[model samples]
Every structure is written in structure tokens, then in C-alpha cells.
Target chain A: MSDLSPVPASAVVRVDLPQQPYSIAIAAGLLDRLSVQFQDVGLTGKQVLLVSNPVVFKHYGDRAIAALEAANCKVTTAILPAGERYKTLRSVSKLYDVALKARLERSAVFLALGGGVIGDMTGFAAATWLRGVRVVQVPTSLLAMVDAAIGGKTGVNHPRGKNLIGAFHQPSAVAIDPDVLRTLPAREWRAGMAEVIKYGIIWDRELFERLEAAERLDRLRDVDADLLHHILTHSCRAKAEVVAKDEREGGLRAILNYGHTIGHAVESLTGYRSVNHGEAVAIGMVAAGRLAVKLELWNAEDCDRQTRSIEKAGLPTHIPLALDPDEILAALQADKKVKAGKVRFILPQHIGAVTIADSVPRDRLREVILGAMGNG
Target chain B: MSDLSPVPASAVVRVDLPQQPYSIAIAAGLLDRLSVQFQDVGLTGKQVLLVSNPVVFKHYGDRAIAALEAANCKVTTAILPAGERYKTLRSVSKLYDVALKARLERSAVFLALGGGVIGDMTGFAAATWLRGVRVVQVPTSLLAMVDAAIGGKTGVNHPRGKNLIGAFHQPSAVAIDPDVLRTLPAREWRAGMAEVIKYGIIWDRELFERLEAAERLDRLRDVDADLLHHILTHSCRAKAEVVAKDEREGGLRAILNYGHTIGHAVESLTGYRSVNHGEAVAIGMVAAGRLAVKLELWNAEDCDRQTRSIEKAGLPTHIPLALDPDEILAALQADKKVKAGKVRFILPQHIGAVTIADSVPRDRLREVILGAMGNG
Candidate 1:
């Protein structure tokens, strides 16, 4: 991304929820000094249940525990097997066992130290553990740091759908260390970029234009630290602001589901194996873009521009050829977001804005999905 | 028990939290008119997932379904195996399957139609399902109607502890039909009385005196209709008031756990099979009374009075002689209420009052348990 004005000295966004407001701290070495960051959010000398996947744990778990121990916390690490398939109640039940063995009190903190899956599961555990304890999120992946880790939406998936079982328990604080991205896989880097592109299209036009200016938006190495700093702050700010307005998704928050309706279906239908969450979201956004244009809700030119950004991020801009259109339609009905048996869609009216459309014609949905298939 | 003042015209206690305030309606034949009652609370034409145990399902499930269907709700029944042993995350997972198959939306309702175990698991399922949905508690047992059903405390037990995994999800409405108690087993009837006695000890002196006025508090049939109505209203009122002031058990709510501290340990040590929740609470209250008297926080006479109430209810006033006192003490350290490694006990200051004691000395606790052993 193009260089912007001087990055703020303090890159923290406050999610001012009515209850349990928290801050997201973004810096390069935040992970190393986690204990200090935890204290900043009022967690200290408490039992900490640090949950992370094996991959992330292997890289940063020791440092995270060390930092927490520095603050006099009794740290217990639960290294869950990495991947979406492992994100279930069974994994969360294991966390409960760890929490009980550690004798974690209601004042104790659950520190989620990985990607969206880790954050979601850990947060769900904290939310339900003793009717809820404090949770501190140290998001390792870009998707988690900017979005999943910031908002209080934490849950595990049901066999039938994505994130079907969860709660709105906000973290005490969200600590983000961009340095962790170096260990993230290339595919994961691109998948995260998809969510970054999502914030650009749905909330911030300046963010969209800046990503368009970048020479390469595919890899973390392609962007310098300043742009990375800008991306993190802008995206976190957008998400924080939206969540502050609607913590429980009662209203207004539905716009954040711009691509998630079909995205979730795609992920669920694939059994969360072939297509990851971000990739599915990217595909869903493309289909939504085409549908918006067909309904004359948005100009085709803006839709193409959005497509260009997704492509530049090296994300899929079309549905996988193997996923049946009819099945995808059926999966959408099973989505947790369905209200009064109506499938709701969040469609971009233009860059930096989206609207919730509840009655998208089934035929238009079918046509757009078929048209957006890979190699169509 | 002696009759209350004209049964208060209408036995409805309002749990007025800042958000999602709901009413607990207590009356005879309330279960038969559940559809109308659900409609009163603004739940109509919604998808309903009715959760119950097999025993309760056999007696009242059809009528419950008929009432819900009459209100134009699409109802699905999930009959779980009865007993505390089945109160685990695995049961909640089955509910998730049922919820998914029924396509329950955010606006949909989960109606819990049994005792505490059913309500706890169903409420937990509702709490996490799609992040959260509305739950309507139809408590069949006296225990659930007074305590478990009114408060939002919903959870499944961890293998290690009671209610170690749970959430505070306030129900949309709690409909109690005292008429259902006719089908309740004598032990269950006595168990429910234990909680009613709890209300007397912790907050309502008049309630305690009323039970003392009764010649028989051991069976539902032994009590007259007016006294039954008073028990439901007064107990619900006490729970509702405490929960409204302290929804998350931050302070005042801990008083509600008056007998639960030691009671949970007894239930856990006995594998939740030997001593049920109410019976355990009865035993716990007995132990708590002795501990309070020994510490000089409460007088022996009032402690004996509390014991007499438990005896009148046909509830156990002493720990099982078969259990080890040392092991019971060890289990206390693992309770969810333990803060900073200190086992907090709610000790009675006097009848109708209790105080939270954080540092109950280990030796003293051991002596109290040993002294309270049955036939000691």
C-alpha cells in the first residue's frame, strides 16, 4: 500500500461497548511484552488460560507465557490442534478441563494467542466458563487481529454451519503484534488480505484506494511497515466503530456480513477443508458484487474495481467450480443469520458502504452464483 | 404451611435487568396455557425448539407442544435422557443438531420444559446457539421454578466440577405451572422444598416461618394450594430481586449460593447421583449453619432453627457418613466460586441473612464437615 502520513504514535482503537469496553493495541513487539499489555487492560496476578493452536504455539507460545508470567500470572497453555475442523465444542470442552485443573477463578483471564479459530474458541470458553470470565485476545493472524479479535463475536461451529454456536463476550483487550505475520503461511497471508480488502470496500474508501496503489498486495513482504501499520489501524478502527454501535448485531451490525452469508455456506459445504473462511468470503463478495450490479443497486464499474482489489490480494474472485449452485442456495437458508426464514444479504451500494437486503430474488441469486463460478 | 396474603392476586415476579427484562409467571395450569403465556411475552409465530427430559416429556410434552402450536409456532422437541449425569457438553451438541435442523433463527425461541438439568443444558444451548437466541423457561420441578429457571445462569457440568461450563443467558420468559409438581417424584418434591427453604434462610424470614408452620413440607400433596402458590411466588421473587441487582454474581448474587458452596462439593463428591442438587444444598445449608455458629458469626439456636426447617422438608441436614471429610474439603478448593485460591463460603449471620466469607480456615472447615456427618 502507498505510504501515508506519519503513523500515530499510539495505534490503539477503543471498542467502547456499553459493557466491558476494551482497546486493541497494535504494535510490532506487542507479543513479547504481553504481560505489560495485559496490565494496561487491568489483568494481573491472575490465572491465565492461554489457548493457541500448535503451529502458533510453537512460534510464540513460550514468549506469551513468559510475558504473562512476568506480570505474575499463573499461565496454563492449551495447544489445540490447528485448523477449522478442530474448532468444535470438543476442543472447547478440553479448554474447560484445563481451566478446571488450573482452578481458574472468575477473575482469571483466558488469553487467546492465535488466529480467528483460536480467538473464537477461547472467547467462547471464557464466555461460558463460570458464566464468563475475562478473556484477553492476542491475535496472531491479520484476520483475527483486525476483525475476529476486536469484536466480541466468539464461538465454535456446529456441524451444519459456520460459527453456529457462539456468544458476544468481548475481550478485556486485543493485543496485536504484526511481527507474528512473518511465520504465517503464504496462503494464510492471502486469505487474511481478503478480510483487509473487505474493510476497504465496505467501510473505508481511502483504504480501498491505498490498496489499489500498492505494487503487490499478495504477500506481507510486499508491503512496508508504515502501510502495514496504516492497514491494521484503519481496519481495526472500522470494525471497532461498527461493533461499538451494535455489539449484539441487533441492528446496523448486519452490514459487516457483506460477504459472510454465502461465504459461510461455501465454507460449510466444503466441510471447511478445501476452501478456508477468507477464501470463501472473497468468493461470496464477488458474487454479491455481481448481484448488486444486476439489481442496479450499484454501478458495474465499482464492482469491477472491488474485484480488481480482491484479485490483487491474490484471493479467489469466483466460486469454486465443484460447489453446486443449488447446494449453495440451500446452505444459505441454513445460515444462522436467517431471520423469519428470510435469507439476508449485505450488498455494497458503492465503495465504502453497504446495505442489508433481505429479499434478494432467488432467481437472481442463482444466476449471479452461476455466472461467478470459476472459469465460467 | 399457612396461607399467604390472598396469593398476591397475580403471582408474577419481574426480573428487570437493564437489558432483556422478563417476567416469571407462576400459577396452576400455566403449562396448559403456555402458548398464550408465550404470546403475552411477545414471542409469537416464531420457530420454537422445546427441550425436555423423557420423564417430563411423557407427562406434559404433548400439551406443551399443543399450546405452542396453537400460538402458531413451528415446534421441535429435543427429549434428552434424564439425570445430572447426562448434563455435559455432548448433550448440548445434540441440541445444536436439533436447532440446526429446525433452522432456528436469532428471532426464534428455545423453550426449556423440565427441571434444572434440562433448563441448564437448554439455556446453555440457547446461549451459544447462533451466539444467542431467546429462551423461555417452563420449569417443571419446584427447584427450577424458584432458582434455576428464573436466573439466566445456564450451563453443563464439567467432569471435574458442577456447572464449571456455563453462561448467564436471561430467558425471555419463565412460565411456572405448580400443577406440574403433581407428577413430580416425592424425592424431587422434597428437593425443590430444599431451595424454598434456602430462600427462607438467605432472604425471606417469613418464608422460613411459614414452612415451620406446616406439619408436612416433605411432599407436594401435603401442602395446600394456597401455600404452594406462596412458595412459588415468594421464592421466585427472592431470586428475581437478587439476580436483577447482580445479574453476573458480581456481589449481592453470591448470597443465593448460601448452601450451594458446600452443596456443590457434596454433589460432585457423590458423582451427582448419590445426592441430587436440592438434597445436597440441604446438606450444605446444614453444614454452613454449623460453621457459622462455630465461627461466632451466627448463634447456635438460629442454626438449629435452619436445621429444623431442612428436617421439616425431609431434606438431609447432615453429610453422608460414607464420604471422607478431607476429600469434601479438597473439592471445596475446586469450586467455581473460589477466588484467588480461597474457598469463599456464604455463612449465615442470622436467619434471613448471610454474608460472603472468603477465608474459611481449612481446619475449621474439616471439623464442621466431620461434625455434620449423619449419625455422628
Candidate 2:
């Protein structure tokens, strides 16, 4: 333990779920020290199944294996195809085949070493394989690092919906190496900034002000080191705190889905092609802000500030021009967020305060979406 | 709730899992009253996916649907192919498609209306669909009525193994109608007796003695009503108690895998053909008893009593002649119970008592297998 480099105290966020509490470690170059992080979290499994995508594996797969093997772990790699299209039960079934062939015992650990797609598939595979096995998330993408990986919401997308099949199987530990974000696509970086900006508007006003003061919020290279660290930690901390309060999205966790209701609908309506998760979330946040203002739930000035932050992050603040407004509304009904024929929306009352509104009028919602797309 | 006939208090076993406690209602004709049972169990979901096999669905599908519809549930049926071979992720994926098409919400209920295969697949589908939904197990076969349906151990089989892809998602309720056993194959009736006999040997000496006293145990018709009721309630009570104490099989739950260790190896070696689950368990119990006696943990007379009871039930008590003893030993290594390369065995200490043994001698196990096959 002494020979291994210690992770900074501030970099680790502990998610205190009642049944299965775990820590999320965020640091640069933490991927190379994956074994130490596993050990720190008390995961002593000798058999490790490292699940990743080809693109991420090409860059950090060898280092991840070397670190695991340093602790005498027997590592098996399953490199899935890179993209949301391949995230299905067929892919998870392939992991099950690999896991079964490798004779992975219940004590075996699953290490997810990629972005949200790989992390979700691997985690779902781990969740259902032998009922469940321990998983350690090594999220390389900013979106996964700050949000997806910390929440323990793992699943694959269905043809009709995204993340329609899943489980709330928490990982034993999460090791986030911000350094790997350097290789992420530029579009994804801006997409991830959308979530960072979301944390500011939903839970942390100080974090919002910090991002508002930044000169550039679009690219990883453009951001200063201090704010980057703050963005990662603060977002993760906010997610962790909410998840701890409501691990299954029963109550408090719904607030975390502030933009996801419409965001998911936009992603679905576009077939998840043009608008990625973060970009859709950005557009949804804009729509939600306008709806709040229109309904007198929040001030127009606050709504404008929210839109300006999304613009600064280079995220879309309007529905895609090609999609029909009615189709988006229909897609919203099919979303996982809907309950008993009512569309539940998370509308903000202030910069850092939001409330769940199940009775949001349909006409008002349609008008806000149309206005965002310049059709109102 | 008032108009429906009350379930006999003696027939219902409440599985008091800390987070998700539920009830198991075992009655003679409960299949026709499934809705009443669901309402009693607090499952008020309006959308239901009724999963069954061709055989069970042919017998009672309409009745089950009519019962749910009586309670205003919009039930959609998915009739999967019958048998263990079809218990794969592909089968589950089909259910996912049906669920998506039905637009089943998180508040939806998945009612499994067949044997272990249907129950397992439906429960697993419910466990993973939309992260999870409520599931009601209406197990038809005797094997399912007493064992599979009551426990929340839901899963599908991988090509290489049984129940490799699964989860521990407890059903909202388990409704076991003993009358469904009337259409069950005679072989299946005897197979379920094996589990009933198991409950006797492991937890209830009285139940074991009652089975020993039965004039005929090969078919459900020959078994007297009082003893049959005792078998259903007692077995479920034992299972529910064990699962409540150890929900995830941490310690106490492993006891439920008593004959399953060797039983699974035998089933896997033969490709789950010729010898069904209960028959294999019967043979495994004989091996475990002899091994316990050889190790001075149990008496020869008690071992003989167990073998005689298995014979009465018309179940195999010896390893098949075609399977190599060496291959059986190898298969045990791949069993889910293996940890740190050691195969864990649940051996009987006495009637109504058992203990887990991890350090059983390999040579002794081989000799027991050889002796059971008349090769010693």
C-alpha cells in the first residue's frame, strides 16, 4: 500500500448507498493505477474481466492490464464495438459468453474501461452475470466520469428507447482518469460540458458561477486545470449525494434528471444520431428553462443565464430542425420518466433549485419546445 | 379485496426480505384467483406482460389473463417455446421486444405463468427491463410450485451453463396453484417431490418422515391431500426463511444448494438431457449422503433412509453409466459454487440438518461417484 501512489483525498467521492456503498476516485492518470484503486476499495478478487471498446482499449488497455496483473490478477479482455448502436443485449450476451468461458467466479471483478457506452454494457453484464459480480468503473470520457459512472445506472438501449434494459448495480469502485479525456472526440467534450453546466444550474450555484467566469468551456485543452478538477469533483459529488439519498430514482434522484426527460425524448426522436446524450440534455435544459419562465416558476433572467451557459459550452439550445414537435411529444410519453400517463418534468425555480412537475400543461410544454426551435 | 375469496392463512408463506418482502400463496386452485392474490400483495400495476410456454399457456393462459383483466390490468401475453434449452438470453430479448411494443412502464407487472423456464426468463426480463418492474411468479409445474417460483433467483441459461446470466430480483408476489400440477407430467410430479424431500432432509424431519410413510410418491394423484399441502407450505416456508436470512446467498442461502453442487455437474455433463433437474438432485443427494457417511458426518442408516425415500419418489440415485467420473469432477470445478478453485459442497450432517464443506477430498468424491455407479 505504501509503494502505491495515494489518491488525493479531495479527488474521491464516497457514494453512501444503504446496501452497497462505494467510492469514486477522480484523478489524472488514475487508469495506470487501477489495481491500487481496486485494493483501496477492498476488492481483492483475483479474476478480472476488463470490458472496453476498441478505441479506448487501443490507448489504455495494456496499461490497465499491467496494473491489474501487478497485483497477480488474471485478466480477460472483451473489447466491444465502439458506439451506441452496438449497446444491446447481444453485446452483453457476448460478455456473458466470455465470462462463462473464462470461468469467472462470483468473486471475480469486472473492470469497465471506456466511456458511458462501454461502462453501461459492462456494468449491466456484471449486474446480471451470476446474479451480480463486483464492477470497477474506469470511465475515460468526461460524460461518464462526472455523471454516468458515479450513479450506478447501467443498461443497454432498446430499439424503442435508450437504457430501456438495465439494473441499479453499483460498482465497487470508480477510477476516473481525466487524462484520457485528451483523446476524446471534440464533439463529445462539448457534449460532456453540457452536463458540467447542468450540475451548476441544478445543484451547485458556485460551480455555475465558476463555469460562467471561464474563458472557454467547449474543449478540454481550453479549460484551466483548477476549474477542470472542480468540474469533475463537484459534478460527481452532486451526483453521489443525490444517488445516496435515492439510489433508485424514487424521489431525490429525480432532480438529477432535470433535463433528461426531454433530453431522452430528443435523443430518441433523432434516433440518437445527430444529438448525443449531452447535446440533447443541453437542448432539453434550454426548453426546461423557458418552460419554467413561461409558467412563472423561474425568472426570465435566470433562464437567459442558463441558455448563455449552454451556448458558451457549445451545446445546442434548441430542438433539431428536422424533427417534428409532435413526434418529440409522443417520444416523451415513451420515456422511462413518465408515470401513470403523466409526463414528469424537472423545472428549475432558481439557478440551483429544481422541482418535479408532473402536471405541466401539454400546450405550455409544446409551446416552449416550439419557441426553442423558433416555431412558436 | 372484499369480494375475492380469502387465501387460507396456512397456505401463504411471507418471504420477509428486508428491502422487498413478499408473500407466496399456495392453494389448490389459486391460478383462477391470481388477480385477487396480486391485489392482496399490493401489485396495482395496470400494464402486465404475461410470459408463459406453449404447454402451460395452452392449459391456463386465458384464465390467468382473465383474472388480471378482472382487476383492470391490460395484459399482453408472450408465449415462448417450452423447455430449458429455450431458457437463453435470446428468449429474454424477445420478451424485451414484447415489453417495448406493449410500452410497459416501470410500474408494470410481469406475471410468469409456466414452469421454472418461463418463470426464470420472465423474472429475469422483469428484473432487467426498465432497470426493474414488479414480477409475479405463477409456477405450474411441481418443481416450480415448491421451489423455483417462491425464490427470486431469476435468470436464463448460457450455452455453457445453467442460470449463468441472472439476477436476485424478488418478485412482488409468488402465486403457486397446486391444482396446476394435475396437467403436469408424471415425471415432473416426481421431480418436484425431490425438492419436497430435500426440504425434509435439510429442515424438517417431520416432513421427511411423512414422505417416508406415503404409500405411493411417484405421482401427485397418489399423494394424500394433507401431506401434499404440508409439502407445499413447509418447503416454501423453509425456502422463504433461508432467503430472508441470506438474500444474496452470502452464507445461509448456500445451504439451499445442498444437492445442487453435484446435481448441477451431472446435469451439465449430460447436457441437461435424459436426467432432469430433480432427478439429478436426487442422484446428487445420494452422493452427498454417502460422502458424509464416509467422512463420519452422517450415519449409514440415515444414508439408507434417504436413498429409500429417493427410490420411493422414482428418482435416480446413482450417476449415469455413460458419464465418466473424471468429467463429473472436472465439471464440479466449473460449477457456480466453486470459489478460489475449491468446489463447495453442502453435505448432510443429519436428518433436518446440513453443513457446507469446502475441503472434501477429491479422491473420496471420485470413489463415491464410482461406487454410486457400481464401479467401486
By summed lDDT, the worst window of 10 consecutive residues in model 2 chain A runs over: A1-10
lDDT of 1 by residue, A1-376 (tens): 3345464334778899987788888887888888778778778788899999988999998898889999999898898988999899889989988888788889999999999999999999999998899999998998887888988999988776788999989988888888899999988888888888889889999988989999898899998787788889999999999999998897888888888888988888889999988898899899898899999999999999999988888898878888898999998888878876678999999899998899999999999988887841
In model 1, which regions exceed 4 Å deviation? A1-10, B1-9
Local distance difference test values of all predictions, in order: 0.88, 0.87
Candidate 2: regions farther than 4 A off: A1-10, A374-376, B1-10, B374-376
lDDT of 2 by residue, A51-119 (tens): 999889999999999999877789999999988888888899899989988999999999899989999
DockQ of 2: 0.80
Q: Extract clashing residue pairs from model 2.
A: none
Mind giving the per-residue lDDT tens digits that candidate 2 earns over B1-376?
1124454333778999888899998777788787788788666548999999988888899899888988788989999998888998889999999998888888899999998889999999999999999898888988888889876899988888889889988898888877788899999898888898898888889889988999989888888667778888888898999999999999989988878888998888888878899998998899999999999999999989999999999888988898998988998998887988898888898899999998898999888988877321
lDDT of 2: 0.87
Listed in order, each prediction's TM-score against the native is 0.97, 0.96
Best of the candidates, lDDT: 1
Kindly give the stretch of ten consecutive residues in candidate 1 chain B with the minimal lDDT sum: B1-10
